[model samples]
Target: MKKEYFRYINTLFVVIPMTLIMAFVGLMRNYGFGEDWIIKFLKAWSVMLPVAYFAAFVIIPNARKLAEKITGKS
Candidate 1:
């Protein structure tokens, strides 16, 4: 893979588990560990994954800048 591909690869690695865990935790909290819980989590994760992946591209850079500004480090 090229260097440019790593950025997208990183996003996929980050987003998949992040959304999966978040979806699981959120639905578990709301609905408990019922039989339908995995189904619900799958539905939520599918929706969240792409949205979160794109949002990360926007949010991560700004967040890094903000952190640098706050901490006086870059």
Candidate 2:
């Protein structure tokens, strides 16, 4: 459990920045969102950021193991 806990922490270190980088890459094509769109996007980020945090902190690290455990896979 301790090892898994550490692994989860390590996963977040990797995931958070990677997610930010990917978001940046996506916005590269559109340097400007316009005032309204930018506000809308910022508003949406309240919901989106936590979902992303969960995925990075919880989902990604154990995803394979969880899938295998669920599917009776090795």
Candidate 3:
């Protein structure tokens, strides 16, 4: 509806799946799968979520602008 509401929902939708996938891959890469892997994944996801949210809001718009400029897409 509103821009603010949409921003939050967008962040949630993007971050949740991304964090889940990346965290699983990263933890498994570093520590390997085990009973403790779930805990490690959740902890890493928790830490990453805020940073990812911040970057999505702050960086993505500028990045899109840069891409548009490079492609002359306007």
Candidate 4:
């Protein structure tokens, strides 16, 4: 119960920053910084947030397993 929710919280923490940085860099690279950059970033964020969350949700568990294997821990 409580532990299960921990993974979701971890995912949110990871996804938000990851998506924010990626969105900013990607938009800056393609569009350049300008007055409308905030708007564009907001739009990209709306799309990327859910996508990244889903990807992380699926990928994180398997990734942790692989890490444990690689590190010979757990």
Candidate 5:
């Protein structure tokens, strides 16, 4: 695949599972476990996934740059 297509596919694969797991753990920590908690977790995950996706793309490049600077790589 082309680079743009690969980046999007990579982002989807990574972000979906990570967001789901993190959101579940975070909500469970705050709210405790229950059927209602499951519903709330799903609702929050729905909002969080897209925000995470966009933020990852924006933040990752800058983070890589900062890391390289710190290490004096390239």
Candidate 6:
């Protein structure tokens, strides 16, 4: 519950969708999967399966720390 909680949440929304897009784009860029094929591959591979949180391994808690200092959550 810090000032940037909303920003953190926005990051999630953006990152997840962006990841899906990136995955599709990547598969196409790498393997030349067509749009329909990318859609199927994404459906097959699933979305937001922890790749986005790799950054959160650092970002979330640091953000929480700043948030805590400001909001005094602890």
**What's model 2's TM-score?**
0.45
lDDT string, candidate 1, 1-74, tens digits: 89999999998999998898899889988999888887898899889999999999999999999999999996
C-alpha local distance difference test of each model: 0.92, 0.63, 0.88, 0.93, 0.91, 0.69
Candidate 5 local lDDT, 1-74, one digit each (tens): 68869988888889999999999899988989876997899899999999999998998899999999999997
Q: What is the lDDT of residue 72 in candidate 1?
A: 100
Candidate 3 residue 40 Cα shift, in angstroms, is 0.9
Note the clash tally of each candidate.
0, 0, 0, 0, 0, 0
Q: Output the lDDT of residue 73, model 1.
A: 100
Off by over 4 Å in 1: none
Model 4 spans with C-alpha error above 4 angstroms: 1-3
* TM per prediction: 0.87, 0.45, 0.85, 0.81, 0.85, 0.45
> Candidates 2 and 5: which is better by lDDT?
5
Candidate 2 scores a C-alpha RMSD against the true structure in Å of 5.3
Clash count, predicted structure 6: 0
Superposition TM-score, candidate 5 onto the true structure: 0.85
Report model 1's TM-score to 2 decimal places: 0.87
Q: What is the C-alpha RMSD of each candidate to the true structure, in Å?
A: 1.4, 5.3, 1.5, 2.0, 1.4, 7.0
lDDT of 2 at 41: 49
lDDT of 6 by residue, 3-64 (tens): 86877677777677767777767677766855578566666346453667567667777998
lDDT of 2 by residue, 1-74 (tens): 58758865776676667666555555545654655655554555445556776777566658878888999989
Best by lDDT: 4
